[model samples]
Target: MALTTLFPPESTATPFATFATETAATPFATFALSSTEAAATPSSTIAPYATALNGVNQPMNILFRNAIWWGLGVLAMLILIIRLMQRAIAHSRHTAAMGLSGEAQAYWSKNRYSTWWKFKRHMLYAPLGKKRHNREIRLSSAGNIGTIPSRFHAILLTIFFLSNLAFLAFLDYSRSDRYSVLADLRGRSGVLAIINMIALIIFAGRNNPLIPLLQISFDTYNLMHRWVGRVVVLEVVLHTMAWAIVKHAATGWSGIWHMVGTNPFISWGTVGTVALVLILILSLSPIRHAFYETFLAVHIILAFIAILGTWIHCEVAKLPQLAIIKAVFILWLLERVARMARLGYLNYSLKGKAWTSATVTAMPGGASRVTLHLPRHVNVKPGSHAYIRFAGIKYWESHPFSIAWVEHKPIHEETLPRQEKETPVEKQLREPETTTDISFVIHAQTGMTKTLYEKATQCQPRQLTLNAAFEGPYGGHHSLDSYGHVVLFAGSSGITHQIPFVQHLIQGYNDGTVATRRITLIWIIRESEHLEWVREWMDLVLKMPKRREILQVKLYVTRPKNPRDIISPSSTVQMSAGRPKIGYILREEVKAQMGAMCVTVCGPGGLADNVREVVREVQDVSVVDFIEESFTW
Candidate 1:
């Protein structure tokens, strides 16, 4: 019997049986049905079969979604528990060491409990390769291709990728018609794609609530965003291909093309798929790094188009996946709104003071020191950065710059002029005059930075002041106050990030509020002239009372003009002609370790990797923690 003869187009009695018979003739033809034909076809017979299919699919979708949420919750819970346990341990050790002499303190440091220390050392903190965690794999001096993921990150990404694959291939085909099975596969892929979009949007946001709750860095979230975006693109491509295959098999190439041209559902879906493919293409590491601003602008535009197309496609198709799309859209909207609010609040002055202004001063080695004079006080801390926009230069562009220094100057009534002090209104207002000066030392690497440097150099005294606006004081809340020993490593311009930590920790030590007993700052620069970048700040830190007792500064001139120029200023402030041996320094620090040690690095990829490796190697011998500050997006 002819397969089509057994199940005529007019039949409506048994939809599954009919579909089975028709599909049996040419299983590929199942997807070729035109929209008109599909609409004209009887639906009553297929309703029961679809309900049966849903019995399997609905639960699977629910399970997968719940699994993602539960996974995040569990991870967050584990981090919280670990933090509490560490605090408890620190308190216990502090109490025990309070009465101990130097020898007893040393003994206690060596004998402290460390059940999870080994696991963290070998698995959590360990790099994919030995000692290369934050270092980028550069294609050349001008281009950094990427960096290796930590072992812990690698494991999580693997599980996430595999889970997505499992969900994509989970459709059952037992006793089901080929047409029905193919349709089920298409639906599953589409549903999964929509679901993954939630994660894609969440991780892309700067104000992602999960960051603080889970203690994950923005760099890690950026990594997750890229991977999740790739997965979403893959699922979208699969979903589109499945539909195309079925359509082409059912009718012909012409019929499928005709449907796409005439059918809103097919046309909108095709548009979204095309946009997503373009996003994947333009987001390659090389292309993204080469034309970051252009890439970012286009990426945002294309992403919006893709989302709008998908929303419309779902609406016209009446797919249940619209709920997921709605959720993703809401998240994207919320992030944008929050970002705008932050910018407005941070930049606008309401107290009749002038708007923020930035003074750009050219420095040696193509770098600029930008000082932002703010109208109000800002809570400045170590490790903080801000996104700054220059209204007179490039109003549309905002770049992240680390806060290198923050100064607060108080206004005294006695310092006011005699005429102003005589005013009755001025006399009634006795509040202290306070202003904040936030500064960033930015290296001229590309676009806006290069322009800023050029403009600064053109001015007399190589400095220019311009109107500007800035958002944040973001990041920098990572605490090093609990550790007794702290080691900071900075390379070239990366000193901007580490300087604040040095200042904050030293102040804490002076106030007797922190557990820190020792601090070592290692700064590596290309030329000896680069030392002038933080000269004033370093002088202030050096002059602090009791600084010599607790602080040690090491300067490494990697490419000095004259090797003899690299001279040690003092015993505590040492200078070297080449890179310091990171491993050797770490080992020595570990030998004389205090209660606990914290190793931090914000430098070139090579330095970060070296520091990471050294920390991992000595983790088992001491209670050590590593924190790396990087902007990898």
Candidate 2:
């Protein structure tokens, strides 16, 4: 009945085929048991190996399989649901704030198809679609929240990272002369260490959630991460030590390395051990990592080398399984390279000028602005940012800068490369532009901005060449739609991100698309030197007839000796004191603006953190209503 039968089924075969010929009767027709089998019968002989399972092994295989299933199935599903709910909450808050009633928002949310629409928008970055398809989707859902990475990623990585912990713990237990530690335990520990090491590398190479968290705060997680690393290093040490001790008790240290190096199972592991030790040394101070930038570069290069060594150590057998493990790293590397390529192309080719040039102009306080001129049309929204690199002076590394605004700019046309199936006319429109221009406001610090500030003050606005790369229009302040008044608080260089937002809000009011809420800008600078950068923009905005109806600007300089020294608009809400804490404002000023008021703050980390804490303490509102960008690394 089957299309092809390569072999006969066991159920249909004769019973004699199940037994070995040697174990059967000598004569095929005779029924007689062999002497060896008769002696080994349960009533005749006792068994020894049958006790090993209950004696030592704990049925780990069955337990581990069950754990894995529960983790991958039930846990993963819950995480997926959590991600969906978070996004739904954010969307509902946004829509409801636009004057929609709770029932109406609920009705919109009830549509199950909208979840699929959201999923499509989030996953547009996946390479399943053609170039034209991607372009169309990018246009349609321009401001959708990108993707929230799957939480199962964190769960799986935690399992692997913890597995390494278990192996290390076992190794330590065996080494401590504890009753639980024995020869068999040592052997099991070594095997588990090897298995966990291989698994850690595999999980790590797949862009695990832990990687991004590490990049952001190495210190917070470094203790646990380092403990695991030390364990792996120690396992290699103990594995070698255990074998060497046995051999040395018989032959001494003369043949230790030779015996260890000759073993195919551990030869590559020996090399990997040396590499890990070297890495541990370099990771410490006096060698490097004291400097942040240099530390990051060296750390990345050494980490890759360490991972390579680990892979080589595991692949001694040259098995297909090991080859597949190595291939995962190769694929991950390729994906990262692809991401870099896409980012580079987007940055280098903006409109047609090849690069944007800027000149640093001093502001009233310690702040400075670098004005940029574009060769052609380029469009970026208020919250959008571009990575900018200036000519000469450490321009090799580009840093992110929020787009202030373009005085005159055109609507950008979305361009797509012509497909093989497209008509020729469509191809003409898709031809790439040669260049474009953009500007960035640099908040002077110790490194790149320090150099820029010196150049700006010492010389003319030099004809600088810079490479511009764009990343996102990711976040915006709470819109003015629901709020009766919008209050924006920015400190020093923080205004670069906030100023454009205010402009966008004012325009929203002017267009009458949303409520004409009052707009208040509070800017705090340590000194008068930084105010020069915004002097022109503040003048222009104040002069506008449309802005006159709603906008108010307040500037506070902490070092002001007299009231006249402050460079702020007329009728400013000037305060004289030490730095103003958000908590103070919440207790004193927020009561009057409590209802239908949305507060947005973007500043240095300390101020931003304070604002968030204050808001949480004072208001019982959803997280969607209060937005803060600290720009903390």
Candidate 3:
């Protein structure tokens, strides 16, 4: 009896599957057919997976793919468990610290060393290399290409990357062109590339539900998106190269071009790969940073084009992986729709109120202070940020800003008239109100920020008002209230992120709601003139109930014009001229050794790395948790 391939011998739409022989001992024998066998099958088939070699008779690629996903899911569960445990430990520590007698504070200062604590500090939160994790590796004084990942992030990425490499070789090498292994590799890579696209889109969006669910920051999601995208691109390249190599062996270059010119599957697949290649090239650190707005616009457009081409390529051949691509498309569309809906709801009040209005004031330095009045009440957490869209200036673009301050004002049920005639006792029966007022201090560097500053400077009183849109309150997942001692380091405009935390902890201290006993703010700015940036808020914080008892501010003006300008404001707030000794401050703080210290820094890459270096070095002396904040593309 003549043996026939399960798929038509001439079927070009075999989803990269190619076989010259139909034998019972082959890897794809499970789908084998004989000349006298059964019935007609579908014209287009997608057999993209690896099977056992030598004597295997069944296709096991599907099980392998499913296993990959299951493995990832299990890993996520493990991470989730670890995170929850950390939070629980933190809560218990906070509770104990708060309940401690004056003597207990000193007694708990000497923490019991454990292998677990060392691992958490040295490995889990450690930088990828010697000390340059968060600091952007700069090409010049103007810009930087990128920063490296932390140790934990690097390890996870490495493992996943290596696994993909391993999967590409899970086929028989004993077989020749008669049963091409190249075709199998092509199919495998294609499947993996398409499968990973799901995660690529999921992590790329700003409104990813996983952020809050996993208690991970957008910074991490953004990192994951970049790495996943790179992997997808590499797989796609390999898939294309494998196909080209196999076809080249069968037919010459002219024949290859002929098929690409006529076959929609081949043509569209090429288009998708080309578009992705362009995206990868232009997305490099230097190119992206130099032309951020252009890069972003082109990036979005190219991404859509690639997805469209890929979908058509798969659909034309009726591959099962089309479903995966469809899910990716749907997810992308849903995220965009959700973002639009959120923007409309937040910026436009349904009760027929005005759109969100923004007041922009040009500060003494090359900075602008943006005060946004949301149409409705907003709950702005400490260390949270927002993406702002200025209606008049590049309204299509949005920039993320750390919310410097937030206030709440009650829209009382009863309003007193200018000439109130009501009894005083009657006015006391009003409802409780929520907090209001949101503000951001933005330093002008380039692009939108520079334009905003120039526009504000042109206006009367060096301030301008316009309509705007707000999207966020994201990235406040880390809480400092759990620690007895807290050290906040800010470089330049990085102060915006720390101000809200200062206010929250001070207020929490007053209300007996937090365990924080000592709060130190170390702000490093270039010039003394920058002090005007947070003068008003600093005044308010300084006046908080029992502020001096727990709060201290240290200002280091790196470029003070005169010696006298660097004077102390009060006993708690001091000013020094020159860059701070990051290691010195961290060591002194650790030596004082309050119960469970938490050191967080939001600053220039150099400052963050410096702080991280010291934090890592002194972890053995104290149970210190180091947190770094730096957002990258």
Candidate 4:
């Protein structure tokens, strides 16, 4: 019996199987073929069973691949469903509490709906460990590695990773010959790699549609993107290795090199694989943080190379994975286009007017207050951030800054003629045009911020106006309007995030548009001079109608030069020396909790973590919700 007669090739298209079958007629094939046939199949009846098993193997491989894809879809849909349910419940509760007050409101605010809230606190909202979410775990003062994922993120990621591993490892290779098994495994890994690339692209995108639909933050999606990218890289390497091992075993290293050199398909595939490996190396936390701007530039360039390589590889190989590659490209292109469109819409002046202007004012505490006079009015929400670009400083660099204040001011002022004989028609026709002013307090750290501060300080008045552009008003859509009791915690320049929230809630309370009746703003600063950063804005907020009734301002100067320097100007706004006891304040607030308490922190990692710990401790005792506004990336 011949080798081809007993162990028939699974497919002529399979490289390994084809190579083996083409050489079966050689003299060495007969001895091994006869021994295998004698031992495995003594009877002719076994031939039908062997053929049947081979047929089942292909379908099983297909089923496994389908199952993995379906599993990912199911998991995403489940998460979406849960988020929708939570939103629906919150909306219903908000509607019910609309007109209720006093005891009735307190009755509604009680933890009667404890089951879902408890589940959220423990699972969906809980940190991996005690209140460490959003706080970057640094190896040293200089290196910021990034934060650990929350418990929910960790569980989902683990499940996804394990699913890929199980699919790769548990394939039925029992009845098939070694070459057939290798070919199937290679194909399986390659298919999964392409599929995973879809997720990698989708999650990494800033314009990911799932973000708004599922109510997941960009940070969470970013975390998913990183992990999914790792999975793709792993699969790519595995796919390449499987083919290389089989090719080397059959035709030696010389043949493998020859094929790589000669075959466009193999060459392009190798290019993509190598690019992915390089990406993995460059994306290490320390390297990524240390040289972020450089890393970002190289990362974008390498990503394009990898995508182009993969696309050409699939095209040359005539593989069906081209569909997924196309999807990835389309997603990336859409995100880029969307970002550009947003930038143009936000920063571009109408009717060929001058570009949007930014006034950079150097503050006392090594900070620059950037006030952008936009071309038109835009509704600014609390906690929103924008990526600002200073063309004069560095054209390519854009930094994310929390929007501290947004105001609409008349662009063109109407002046009455000095003569008393001004016509009524002229007076009636002259109306001032209004434009938006968006401001951000940028603390002088390294890179662009430091340069900005230095440039602003160089001016005689410590302020300079220059043409600037900005994209978005991203994030900050998180609402505190639904809660009756809201506590805002800010540390140093983190106060930028809280100021808008305070203003919004106070305004909402005045207008009777929000449920919030009690608002607490706690700011922790190193020096009292730092208070000048938002002095004008704070004065405006303080003087708003009925402000003193609902708002309480607590200023804690951590390193006050003198104890006497900490002076309370009013009973409502009190200044104290030293750091705040986070637990004590939280406990005191919860004791007089009004309704659905929201504790939000935007500050240093340690302060945020401290707030989180205290919030978690008192969650069971009151209707408390934790919202941490930190930009980990």
**Which candidate leads the pack in TM-score?**
3
lDDT of 2 by residue, 1-633 (tens): 431142122122222222223222232222132222222222221121111111111223223323444654574466556555645654554444445322233332232454443433333111222211111112233222111111222344466557545533432232222212222233333444443444334333323343232222122133234444556566556644554454454345664555456754345555656666765665443333224456546655755665565467546433222543465456547646754664555444354534445555644333457655544334555655555556676755555566665454322434423363242232244223312334456777666777766666665543233333343323332344545456677877778777777776666666554443566677887776566666566665666557765666666677765656654335644444346655666544354342244567777644554554555444432211345544432
Backbone clash count, each prediction separately: 10, 23, 4, 0
- For model 4, the superposed segments whose C-alpha errors exceed 4 Å read 1-65, 414-433
What does the lDDT read for residue 391 in candidate 1? Answer: 78
Candidate 2 residue 383 C-alpha distance from true site, Å: 4.0
What C-alpha lDDT do the candidate models reach, one value each? 0.75, 0.46, 0.77, 0.77
Please give, for residues 1-633, the per-residue lDDT of candidate 3 as tens digits. 222364333243332332223232533454343111112113112221111111121143454567678877898788789889888988887777776532356645555757866886678778887777877878897777888888989998998898888877675555423224555567678888988898899989888887776778888888888898999999999888877765665455875686678878788888899989999998888988888888989999999989998999888766657788989999999998998888988887766365888999999989999998887667777889999999889999989999998865444534433455343322433323322468999999888999999999999999999999998877788888877788999998999999999999988887787778888899999999998998889898998889998888999999888878888988899999999998899898887767778888988888988988888788677678878777555
Inter-residue clash pairs, candidate 4: none
Whole-model lDDT for model 2 versus the true structure? Answer: 0.46
Scored by lDDT, model 1 comes in at 0.75
**Each model's TM-score, in the order given?**
0.86, 0.60, 0.88, 0.87
Model 1 bad stretches (over 4 Å) = 1-56, 87-108, 111-115, 411-433
Candidate 2 Cα deviation (angstroms), residue 162: 7.0
When summed lDDT is taken over every stretch of 10 residues in candidate 4, the lowest stretch is: 47-56
> Once superposed on the true structure, which residue ranges of model 2 sit more than 4 Å away at CA?
1-83, 99-290, 318-328, 347-368, 371-386, 406-437, 461-487, 511-520, 536-552, 561-563, 572-578, 587-600, 621-626
